[model samples]
Target: MMMPAAPETDAVRLREAMTESLKTSGALDDPAWRAAVAAVPRHRFVPGFYLPAQEPDEHGLTVWEPVTADADYGRWLAAAYSDRTLITQFDEQEPDWAAPRVRHGGTPTSSATLPSLVLRMWADAGIAEGHAVLEIGTGSGYSTALACERLGSAGITSLDADPKRLETAATALHSCGYTPTLAVADGWYGYWPEAHFDRVVAVCSFRAVPPALIAQTRPGGKILLTLSGWMYGYARVLLTVSGDGTAEGTLLPGTVSFMSARSHAAPAFGNPAHWVAGLPEKARPVRHGPERITAATAEAFHLRYLAQCAVPDAQLTTFEDTVVLVDVVSGSAASLTPRGPGWDVREAGPVRLWERIEGVLDAFDASGRPGPGRFRLCVRGDEQFLSHPRLPSLPLPSVGYGRASTTGPSASRRMPGSGR
Candidate 1:
């Protein structure tokens, strides 16, 4: 592959913006991370060309980038540095491959995740000087670069499932002057070359803590991961590797959405029989707006918590007229059933998922609205616990998301399940 022409001006602007933003976000406080973020030009790794548009009041966000255009490349480079997410893969269009691949708006296989979240994970990992770090999912080597900048090249090993992505990352890292060990392998398996490390960071989501991850860490090592559980949403968990390789940590503030590791890809949609057998008990049937909750609760931390509880197999499916969320494990489903007045929730399963959720809301209601400050999380082995200042805070008896229940035979549209 030919090296794309450099955009010096764009790189300068990105460096300024990122430096300022990191300063404001306190990410610049650490000299190593500051130098790393400042030294790396976000544009060099992303060679795409983004089209721009204007709106009445606000500018249209650079939604997608053309991978091969040289003239309009600045936008791509700018976005690469900005806090925005740069989608690196969608369906068959691998950004590392040749250009003109038709893009879809469905799932994202890889991305340089938002900067704030990136720093948050880095801080959560608690890496000290010379700490050996193993990173899962080396997308574009952006985070890997940051790790190298912090841990140095000899202490970092980054892995990804796709060889193409790893190749691109390797090239990008070498060009940027960092040589972390790069491997094309499933992140779930982790890297066995190194038995123990001071830190482990997973940029992807997992159904549960993998045994391999735990086994790879030495006692007292910290494992930073985005865990799926049954709390308010998905949480960034900071776990301490135990002597026996088992680890546990409390949920941190903030949220992130990540592609699940390839080895633990979400399962297929449900059949009527399967749904019937997996129904959540005590669930009530009602109409509610599914999109409202989905958008408001896009926090990966909370989603991960819920997945750990009520609906371990919960997935979100959005359609033209309806938004569906199903907990296949509990045979429960929640749909934003449209009514004349507005959208109400129609939920059915073994447990009254809405009532249980309302129970949490009610606790919040009783306590007034408890913000993040009032929230406290505690975890013990498989038992993860949470409490906040608010209404109906129930000690979640299970670990999962509440599923969307559907029983009607007249249903028309449906798609694959989204494992939260």
Candidate 2:
């Protein structure tokens, strides 16, 4: 009699499925990367994660419930193998994995990013064998494990700002038979001890490229990260460090949003009521044409980015027919609403917020409507400026304004709210 075929393990089957899906989806192009994904056991890294509660409790509030592999192996394994992000922490607090309970109302603080996104960013980095890679934001250590498999443990160093997160990641990474250098430090500072890295990959987003990252990366080395701002718009960018400590690069084609780097996260806005408590202290109606750039269309991605670049600390919100812009630091607010063939503009505080927005929208429209890819970023020392071939250079507010003001009716006045 022929020997019976061996049984297939769940982990192996799930891994194969995920790898094949990534390949079919065009996310995993390289065989080596596919192998790395297959070899690393992601389920081992995320023992527990938060899922949206199915139904609100008697209190009528939606919440996130913790699910663990031990509590429901089949369900947890299914989720682990799915091609989606898994929230591992809420408000920077670790979930009690052992307890089968729900936590009420908190924003996601950390997560194991979607597998396809992680692989795509790695592909963008184009890491070579034996390349020294420094990974910022080592959440759950899944990406770290993938890096270790591709570059070997000796070539990888992972850092995070949370000591608790680092401790947990260390345990999880060790369980997978890999031990890369793990550090608890603010990623904004870029671990200086491991300077001159061949590549730097930041899993977290920030308002601007950290100067220390450029200092630590070797000339010609690439840094891949997502640029995000208070408006919640994000663009993935790949920058190459120059010999003079300056870095220049273009925004990538796709959209990728990550949690803001811990040190760069904006201060809490607290209650929504507090934000919209009072009417505009002063309001005057102005006439303008219907918005040529909006947050609803495909081109809106670049428009929103331009807006954020123009107004650094402005918060943008959209209702059915109105766009609300507010800069808490400057106490400036604007409401742009549709009015027949034109727009009704209301402004408050010292800054001409509505006029500034109109100027940006008009500039963007006049520039042949270039996409994010057409924009280039140049960073020298502490200042960063964005430029497009068709448009004039615009300095990011994080750095002092480099060119004369072109904001609005008060073109000579300094733009308000000028910090990350």
Candidate 3:
């Protein structure tokens, strides 16, 4: 008897892989998600490019060209549509209009967010049948397809700032025989002309909630978006727009990275090396500190200081030998490096930023027992007020406008709040 034929192509293998992922993730029963995943031809959505496999090195990870072939189209397709994120934009934007090139494993600007995460976020928003949903950030339009499939054509509107991406997505949708109102506009504005949406979903992340978003959403509507700039991980917030024009929601457990909306795109941190060159000459190392704490707690502590310090821009990245922090405010960046047995701060101005962050964590530890239940978020219009169970709201101290907190004497205070 002839044996069963081997898996013939990448697309075939991809289907099997995705099927297996569904089985293991317990997402098979999700009909809307299954239908959306199956209906969208993922191959059509990807560009003709692939990221090189990573090679670990002494300095850091290095990237080399990925072996590409005809079947690679299917591998890319499967990866693009899988239950994980596929980075689509790097450094700043799409590298090439047609094919993206992989450089130093730089920051991702856009991507196809994980399918399961998208589905859960959509479900969490409580999108109902025939509900008018306003989807902000139409990255590849894969999520928009899912939205259209769930809400139907007449009730959904999707917006994106990148006109080229929109055009590509429109074509892909037409090929799949589905169409929704696609607009080329800054999603941060929330397409106010089409207000009163039952659900507002931002596929991208934001530093603060936009006023237009609150105004456009109908009272009692659901607003699901990512509250970004977290030290450890971004929180997926499910908010309910209240009758009083304010919204509040608990943070979901899952964490996912996303492109910041164009209007809220992070400003550049000037000359990364400059910060490295300005190391403080008299800094001492602090002993007795632990190496690996809960990533969540670590991130939260960092975010707390960022908010309280009134720093306009700060970025944190960890390495085997060091944890590097780059702070850019008023177009100048201060680099702080924490290495084995010692700490160094490099900048033209305040040099104790790193110590201030560490101190915040220590103070929180001193509070005895502050945990998840203690963390809180409150935003009204352009102001955000944060308080933990044991801590109270205080004024945000200024530190050379657009900088992170480096001072140690200020009372528990609020920083420049978000404009939401």
Candidate 4:
């Protein structure tokens, strides 16, 4: 009698399926990237992860259910190869890998970033054979595996702030036969021992490009990262390091959000009432009529980016039809609501939050509401400035205009006065 043919392992079949899906979705266009995806077993890296349940629990928190291969191989394998982010840690706590279920109330501290996004960033980094890459935030080592496949193991160095994450990534990478340099250190300070990387890619978002990254990158090296701000506005940025240590680049035409680096994470904000109470005694109303601009609108996305660039630490909260702006450090607060023909504006705080916003909105309007791609970033040492070729570079403090070109017509125009 002929024996039945042996069944293929679920991990192998799933990985192949995932590779095909990625190619079909146009996410794995590069043959090498596709091969990398196929070669590495993602299931091994993420043994257990939390998935949001359809219904939340009694505490008004989303119920995160744990999934493991032992209990249910099908679901686990499906999730492993699926193009979705898997939360590996919550509130800096790693969930029990063997637990059948668990609930997490804290924010996601670490995760395996979506595969498509990882490939996109990798493609943008322009990693070629023999290129030495320094990867920041080696969360799951999935990206590291891909880089290793493209560039040999000797050409990759991955760093993470969390020691636990580093340990986990090292094991996963080794299991996949990749022995990239893994270090437990702050990503803000690029691994100095191994300097002069051909490319630097940050998996986490940053308010500003770390000077160390620029210093460690070889001239003409590319740096890919997601630049985010207090408003939660994010844009993918690709910068080319210059010989003088200054890097300049334009914002790519897309939106990407990632967890902030642990070291650079924003401080927790106190009660909003405290900020509102600290406002100046005098109250004011805005002159402009009710505008359609808002944080949710597509066109306003770039405006939000500009707003965050102007006030790096400002926080925005929206409810119903009103938008509340608060700066914890400066103790400034402003509430703008639609009333009658114009917005009812309330201002309190030393920072003149409403007036600052008004000036930014006016500037945005004057510029015909340009897209985020029009914005350019110039990094000189620790200071980074965002400007438009058509508009004067607005240094951080002015909150209005930047240095104007003498020869050519100035994109810098006088900001409209704030209505008191």
Candidate 5:
């Protein structure tokens, strides 16, 4: 009779299968990355993670259930090696796999990103041999292990905001025989001791590429991350740092997103009625449909991205065919509703919120409507902005914007990849 394959042997086989799947999916093309994926056992990092259960909670939000290795070894290993993103922590709560209770509803605060996407970012960031890398948001340490496998532990420095996560990631890395440098600090502030890395890559999302990251990178080094906004739009950005403390690059083609840095996420905006009550009674008709600007359609996705560059802190809300954008801190608000052929809008507050959004969409149209490929990013000293050759350079929103608060319904958004 044939002997049963050992658990570790099974892991090797599953890891190899995942590598092949990524190859076929076009998420990975480099032979070095393929080898890294084949060698590391991802199950070591996420022995237990959460998956969205089919059932919705009483509030109609997604309910999450844990998939622990102890509960179901076969299923757990399979999911760990699968291409899907595995959520490891929720609402900043450290998950207790032993208990394995069903979570009614909570935001995903940490996750092991989709396997294929992790490898893709490795390739996209152009981290080659002998290059020292500073990896931001060491959530699972899976990516760090992959880097250590090819680049070696001595040159890879991984950082995360939570001390608990860094401790957990350090343990996982040690199990994988990696002793890469691990630091605990907010990714926005960046790790300072190990400055001037060859590459700086963030798995987390940001409103703008933090100046600290640019300051930490070597003169010729590259910085890769996704720029996100309260509007729920995301775009891939890669830039080369300069000697004068600046970086410039264009948006990479294809869709991309990531969980916002906790400090960078949108603040709760209280009640809609309160803001709506402040708007003017009369409304003005506009040329374009509100759907074109606010809908989740593929056509409008990039349009929202443009609007985000114009006004990063502008939060979106929609109800009963009416769409509104609010600059809560600046006391700006606008509401739009469908009219005969176009839409009618009412504006209020200091900033002309709707007018700015409408102007951006119009400018984009006048420039032959270049796709996301035409988008450019430039970071200069304290200011960061997006610029197009034909259009004006739009400055990113300033940080520390305040919000009004009152009990209210949750705003609707179309953020993909539940979170990290």
Candidate 6:
């Protein structure tokens, strides 16, 4: 009879397999990235993770079950080496991996972002040998370990708001022979004491590029992060910081998303019904039907993003027949119901949500319906705006154009692959 292999042997085998898989998939095109992937053990970083159950628990939110290494090392190691975003924390609470445990009705505050994603972002940022890197969001430290393999531990500085996560990442990095700088601070602010990093890569999405990032980065350095919105639109951008404290860049082709930074996240707005409760009917008829705006067509998908530009503060919710836009902070709400030829629109509060969305949609159509890919972003100090050759430059989430929240981007649309 054959004896079982040691855990270390299995870990090496699995890590090799995962690296090969990433290379085959084109995620690890650079040999240096591949070597880093091959060298650093991913299983060391993610000891366990949470997977959602098919049925939600008492709370309406999905309940996630924990898989732990102490309970089953074989399974945990296999999964850790896989190419998936492992849910590490739910509302700041790491799952009780002591046994099979579950968390319900809580948001994924942090995670070990997918391996391909880590490699992809590193490639996009052009992280290289001898270049110092500042990584935002050090969850499990898997990405940081890969960076260590590429640039050595001394060249990397990574931070997270959660001290526990940083502690865990530090332990994991040490085990893999990496002891990079791991600090506990809000990633949105960047590492304050450190300055002049060659590349700043954020695993989390931001509503606007933090001005602190531009100030800290070397004049020609790059800031790689996803620019998300209240509508949950993801635009991964690579910004090159300038000496004048201004940064500008074009959107990367792919749709990449991460959980919004706590500061940039949509404000908490409870119950859509509360905002739509009592709104007066519109006095004038509108030109277009709400059907066009609430549509399932490609145009509607694009329209959702366009609406995000116009009304940064309104959260959208849909019912069987009607769609509602509620801006809890502004005390503004728009209710759309069917009428004979057009939609019956109602409004309450300071801003007219429907009229704004209509105006944006009209402009989008008139601009020949440009896809989001053609857009460019310019960041100067605090404000950031989206620009295209034809369309107008619209303010992004940071400036607080208006106060809106997100129950989600839309009831019908699924959040992208990032899971955050």
Winning model by TM-score:
5
What is candidate 2's lDDT per residue for 1-420, written digit by digit as tens? 221232126778988999999999998888899899989989878888977878876776668777776666777777788899999988887777767577877778899898998898788998889788989889989999998888788888888877777778888888788878887777766766666689999999888877777878899999998888888767778999999889999988865779988756766554434444444544445544324444356566656677677778777766457667778788777776666666676666777666776677777778887888898999987678888887767666562222222111111111121101
Residue pair clashes in candidate 4: 279-348, 279-349, 280-349
Which lDDT tens digits does candidate 6 get at residues 199-245? 99999887777776776788999999887766665567889888888
True-vs-predicted CA distance for residue 290, candidate 6, Å:
7.9
The predicted structure with the larger lDDT, 1 or 2, is: 2
- Clashes (backbone N, CA, C under 3 Å), per candidate, total 71, 0, 9, 3, 0, 2
Considering TM-score, which of the candidate structures 3 and 4 is the better prediction for this target?
4
Residue 409's lDDT in candidate 3: 19
Tell me the lDDT of candidate 2: 0.76
Query: Where does candidate 2 stray beyond 4 Å?
Result: 1-8, 53-62, 270-297, 318-323, 337-343, 399-420
Alpha-carbon deviation at 131 in model 6, angstroms? 1.3
lDDT of 4 at 89: 91
Which of the predicted structures, 3 or 5, would earn the higher TM-score when compared with the native?
5
Residue-level lDDT of model 4, residues 193-273, one tens digit each, is 667789999999887777777888899999998877666767678999999989988888765789988755667776665
Residues 1-420 of candidate 1: C-alpha lDDT, one tens digit per residue:
333555665477678888889888776677767777887766666655223233222342234434543443544565677876667776424654344543323456777777767777887788878788888888878888887876678888777777777777778788888878777666655666654678889998765565566667888898877654322245566778778545656656665657777656666665534433343333333433343345555332343354334444556565456555666566676555466666655567665454445444444445654444354444344444555544223243432222211111111111111000
lDDT of 1 at 399: 25
Runs in model 3 with CA error above 4 Å? 1-20, 47-49, 56-71, 91-104, 230-233, 276-280, 284-312, 317-324, 330-352, 367-374, 394-420
Q: Supply the global lDDT for candidate 4.
A: 0.75
Alpha-carbon TM-score of each model against the true structure: 0.73, 0.86, 0.76, 0.86, 0.90, 0.86
Report the C-alpha lDDT of model 5 over 72-128, residue by residue, as the tens digit.
778778888899999999889897777878888788889999977888788888988
Model 1 C-alpha lDDT versus the unseen true structure: 0.60
State the displacement of the C-alpha of residue 263, model 4, in Å, after optimal TM-score superposition. 1.7
